[model samples]
Target: MESKILVVYYSLEGNTKLIAETISEKLSSDILEIKPKKDIDSHSKMKYLIGGKQSVIKEKPELIPYDINVENYDILFIGTPVWAWTFAPAVRSFLESTNLKNKKIALFSCNGGANGKTFENMKDKLQGNEFLGQIEFKDPLKNDREENVEKARKWAYDICKLNIK
Candidate 1:
């Protein structure tokens, strides 16, 4: 079977994007960024905090323009930051917008803490596809791009192998 992988993610502070890019590099996959339809107020830290919590509580997100054909890829390498123990609202929005039936999916999360709980939350949300596995780079690695990249690459390779693709 032929396979095409797409690395899709949302980054509040760019670390998640870096992780996605690293996965793409290791897998030679395409990349897609999920942007919010509504912009958060430039100076409002409270808005981000509130919005992120609302997103997780509601299990939804409002996404901006995404052009990916959900059916085109065989594997999806989904990356996101953990917000309120789940993916960022933008990532949730992206998942809700797309269909993943019969696809192979893996998740990667970068968080400010250990993130085991966050991964569990994400693993549940990704049920539309075969949940190959997940990788989490916790607190120390969040701002360290070089280290996270290597970690993401390894995660990507391991997932690729685990799925026997």
Candidate 2:
């Protein structure tokens, strides 16, 4: 039986989007981009302050319009950027809103250097789901784009193989 897969992610600096897009293409899965109701300023230092505060507090930001039906997808590849050593507030919101029980989840994150508890946080938020695996990219945007894409492709392939079994 063919599995229905979806790549859902929230990106502030486009690094996570790049990884999500690569994985979506590899899996031939539909993709959804999660957006906050209020936009965060990517260019401002205040963005870090607010994001860090929210992440540390585990605040869930309200999401904007999104139409993906999570129930249709059997496998969800969720991606987010690491902020304050955890997943972004937008991702937190998504997890809080979505019903993921019995779904197979694979997590991925884009980070500058430290990933401190990102995967752990995601797992904590998403209970009662089968976690396939997780992958992390270190400063993918500031580093080599080609290398990052290659890594994402390989990771996606590996995840797909595991899910198939």
Candidate 3:
């Protein structure tokens, strides 16, 4: 059986977006990019400080209009950039607005170092869902691109093979 899949993500510096696009291509799924009503500063030294503070406080930044209905998809693949050892605040905002009860979810993150608490934080916020899988890519833009693409392809295939239903 073919499951309906949606790839939703928030990207800063374009790393997470690249990974999300690859996964969406591999799975031939619909993709949505989460954008904040107010864009976060990516070029400032205080970017980490501000992002980390919002994530720690669980602040849900207002998101721009996104057309895809969460209820229409069977499997949701959420991607985010690792900020302050956690998923970005924009992702938190997206999670807060959408209902994922009883849905199958797969997570992915792009980080410079460790995945940190990205997956853990997402699991915490997204309760009552069947978690299918999680994958992390380290510095895909600055580091090995070909290898990360292969890894993302394999991960997407594995997600398709999951017996979530």
lDDT of 3 by residue, 89-152 (tens): 8998898888889888999999988778889889998999989899888989888998998899
| Higher-scoring candidate on lDDT, 1 or 3 | 3
**Which residue runs does candidate 3 get wrong by more than 4 Å?**
163-165
Error at 99, model 3, angstroms: 1.1
lDDT of 1: 0.74
Error of 2 at 120 (Å): 0.7
Q: What TM-score would each prediction reach against the true structure? A: 0.84, 0.96, 0.93
Highest-lDDT candidate: 2
- Model 2, residue 14: displacement in angstroms? 0.6
Per-residue CA lDDT of model 1 for 1-165, tens digit only, reads 758888888876667777887888888888988877775563686966776666557646567776778679988888877776667777767766766788888888888774646667666666766888888776424466677677777878988876644
In model 2, where do residues sit more than 4 Å from their true spots? none
Error of 1 at 97 (Å): 1.9
Ranking, TM-score, top scorer first: 2, 3, 1
Which prediction has more favorable lDDT, 2 or 3? 2
lDDT of each candidate versus the true structure: 0.74, 0.91, 0.88
Sorted on lDDT, best first, the list reads: 2, 3, 1
Prediction 2 global C-alpha lDDT: 0.91
Candidate 3, residue 154: Cα displacement in angstroms equals: 0.9
Q: Any idea what lDDT model 3 has?
A: 0.88
